[model samples]
Target: MSCVQTIQDYGLRSLGFGERLLPREGFTLCEQFTLIGSGIIWNVYFGALALAAGFLLATVLAVAKQSHNRWLRKPAEWFIFIFRGSPLFIQFFFAYFLFLSLKGASSFFNPFTSAWLGALIVLFLNTAAYTGEIFYGALRSIPKGDIEAADAYGLSGWTRFRRIIWPTMLRLAWPAYTNEAIFLFHATTLVYFSGFPAWQQKGDALYYASYFADKTFNPFVPYPIVAFYFILVTLGIIAIFGAVNKRLNQHLPQEARRKLRIRPQVIR
Candidate 1:
């Protein structure tokens, strides 16, 4: 088949559209690229949803962790610790079985066992713990002078936090948080590789790459395509976050504004 025909056939195969059967033999470069690209849909879905949902929970956890009240503080501390301390692969393993047990109790828990919901939940909680710690550090790092200045302006309670503290915390934490966001997207590859099974043949980019690799007994071609896709994703992330960082620091003089320094995690 022509490359365009191949594209039309497999472009959205990962979403269960276009074609149902994967090509079995004489795999061409175009087929590999098209099918693998199709699988990226799941990766983006998991990463985007988890990142957006986790942001709010992370902020709340950060505030709770920093709170004086023992009730709020202790639970937040343990939640962050448990999620952050364990390996994510183990979390996925445990979560799948846990959900399976719950499925026995109630039919409503059925969806929770699937990767769409289960893996997303795992990623959401994982990112939230990591992000909560980042935000907590930013909260602690908030300039005392800024708080004093707010107090001088008769700002207190939620209004003061909403106006003064929150923005500053975001400004301080954003660079590091950008790194977290990148890592979380890259981590989506682990979803199908983990305990959560991909229904039918639907899986992420890594899943498709692995399929090609196993069939051809050649890891070099397909794996690099996966990397290329993720590299583009990383660039897109950097562009978006850098723009937000600029806006966050827009009020300050250019010389006073902190430039975003992307330090990718070598080992998470």
Candidate 2:
């Protein structure tokens, strides 16, 4: 088939919207690119939803961890510790089985056994833990003078937090948090490879790349395509985060601003 025909057939195969059957024989370069690109849809879905949800939880976690009350602090501390201390792969593995067991208890839990929900849950909690620590450090790093300034202005409680503490925490943590966001997207590839099974051959970019590699017995081509797609993803992430970083630092002069430095994590 022509490349255009191939695109039409497999462009959305990963979403189960296009051709149901994967290309069987004599796979061409167009087919590989098209199918793999389609699979990237899932990666974006998992990363975007997980990152957005994780941000809110991370904020709460950071506040809880900073609380003097042990009741609030201890659970937050342990939650972050458990998720961060263990490898994410193990989390996905155990989460699948845990959900599977819960499936017997209620029909509502049925969706949790699938990658769509189960894997997303794992990603959400994992990123929340990592980001919570980042925000906690930022909270601790807030200048005592800033707190005093807020107090002098009669700012206290939620007023202080909303006007001073929260924005300052975000500004300080953003550079590191940008790195976390990038890493989280990269980590989404682990979803299908982990215990969560891709139903009906619908999978992520890595899943399709692996399929082509196994079928063609040539790892070089499809694997590099996966990398290319992710590189584009990384670039898109950098662009978006960089804009946010700029806005966060807009109050300061350009030279005094803390520019975003993406330090990709080699080990997590």
TM-score of 2: 0.98
TM for every model, in the order presented, reads 0.98, 0.98
lDDT comparing candidate 1 with the true structure: 0.95
The ten-residue window of minimal lDDT in model 1 covers: 259-268
lDDT of 1 by residue, 1-268 (tens): 8999999999999888888899999999999999999999899999999999999999999999999999999999999999999988899999999999999999999999999999999999999999999999999999999999999999999999999999999999999999999999998999998899988899899999999999999999999999999998999999999999999999988798878787777424
lDDT of each: 0.95, 0.95
Q: How well is each residue in 139-176 modelled by candidate 2, as lDDT tens digits? A: 99999999999999999999999999999999999999
Worst lDDT run of 10 residues, candidate 2, spans 259-268
lDDT of 2 at 194: 90
